[model samples]
Target: MVRGACTLTAERADTDRVLDALPGLWQGFSATLIRDCRLRFRRRSELANPLIFFALVVTLFPLGLAPDSTLLSGIAPGLLWVAALLAVLLSLDGLFRDDFDDGTLEQLLLAPQPAGVLVLAKIVAHWLTTGLPLALASPLLGIMLSLPGHSMGILMSTLLLGSATLSLVGAIGAALTVGLRRGGVLLSLLILPLYTPVLIFGAGTVRLAVEGAPLAPWLALMGAMLALSLLAAPWAAAAALKLSLDG
Candidate 1:
């Protein structure tokens, strides 16, 4: 009886420690996110480039292809997804490049907090500065492309989910190529293939929305991808960062 009672007490103490760790972990994560966000947005031109690139790519589709609404609407979903993916990819090369150049990334790896948490925070910052803005700006491009009005919501939704997934996936590529002088091309080559599934379902979501079909399945797939990527991407990215640091 005494042994069982002691065991219960030990379990309770372990539970208490786990509960206590949650708040401290959250504080650390939030602080890192805020710091990275401030650093990223401090320069206006650099911050605006991705959003601009997204818009330009979308805009060019209308001019390059026929201006007819029927044809444009048919292709808009894929066009937008492809453009957003490229924009996200463009921003990724710089994810750890600057930090590596100046040794800040090394500092982050050495910090007491887990490197996975740090990588997750950086990914969040990347999504906020680059991905979120692209999603917000997408509706304007959608309208310009003559995309069906009803599809606008789904377009934004997919970009939000899809872009977050892209940022997470791209970070892994970024971490791996961060030490290279010509890392941009290598990052794109490594990440573009991994990006294919998200691109397919993301464009499919908007296409279904435009056709007035049920959206649950595509959105479900996207949500599942997001969940799985959320669990896996940061840890993979952190490991890549450690490898880069080793050399």
Candidate 2:
């Protein structure tokens, strides 16, 4: 009976320690998030590159194809998704390059908080700077593609959710290649295949919305994918970062 009581007391003590650490962990996360955002914003041109690429690809598609509104509308879903995917890819090569160059990444790994938490903060920052802008600008691009007015909301919604997953998944590739001199091509090779499902479901959701079909299933799938990525990608990326740095 005495031993049982002692065990319970120890468990409660550990629980209290964890509860005490929660606020500090949250502050670390927020500070990292804010710092990343401010640093990215400082480089105004780099911050705009993905958005520019996204717009240019969407704009040029109409020029190369027949100017039929129905045809443009038909292809818009896939085109937007592919373009957005590539744009995200283009920005990913530099995700960890700056940190690695300046030795900040090594410090991040040594911090008291888990590396995954800091990496997840960076991923969120990437989405805020890159993916969020793409989702917001999609409506104008959708109009250019002659997409149905009602379907624009769906396009934005899918991009918002899909892009978060992209940032998470892409971070793994970025972490893996951060030590490479020229890992851009290698990064694309590593992550492009992984991106196929996101492309399919994201575009499919928009297509269904255009067709006036029920899109709840597609959105649900996207949410599931985002949830999985949220849970797993940060830890995977953190491990990769450790490997890259150690090697």
Which candidate number maximizes lDDT?
Answer: 2
Please, what's the RMSD in Å of model 1? Answer: 8.2
lDDT of each: 0.92, 0.95
Q: In candidate 2, which residue ranges exceed 4 Å CA deviation? A: 1-23
Q: What's the distance in Å from true for residue 245, model 2?
A: 0.5
Instruction: Give the runs in model 1 whose Cα sits over 4 Å from its true position.
Output: 1-23
Which candidate ranks first by TM-score, i.e. highest?
2
Tens digit of per-residue lDDT, candidate 1, span 1-247:
9999999998988798576454466777898899999998787799999988988888798788788998998899999999999999999999988889999899988876888998899999999999999999999999988898888999999999999999999999999999888899999999999999999999988998998999998999999999999999999999999899888
| Model 2 residue 81 lDDT score | 95
Number of clashing residue pairs in every model? 0, 0
Worst 10 residues of 1 by lDDT: 17-26
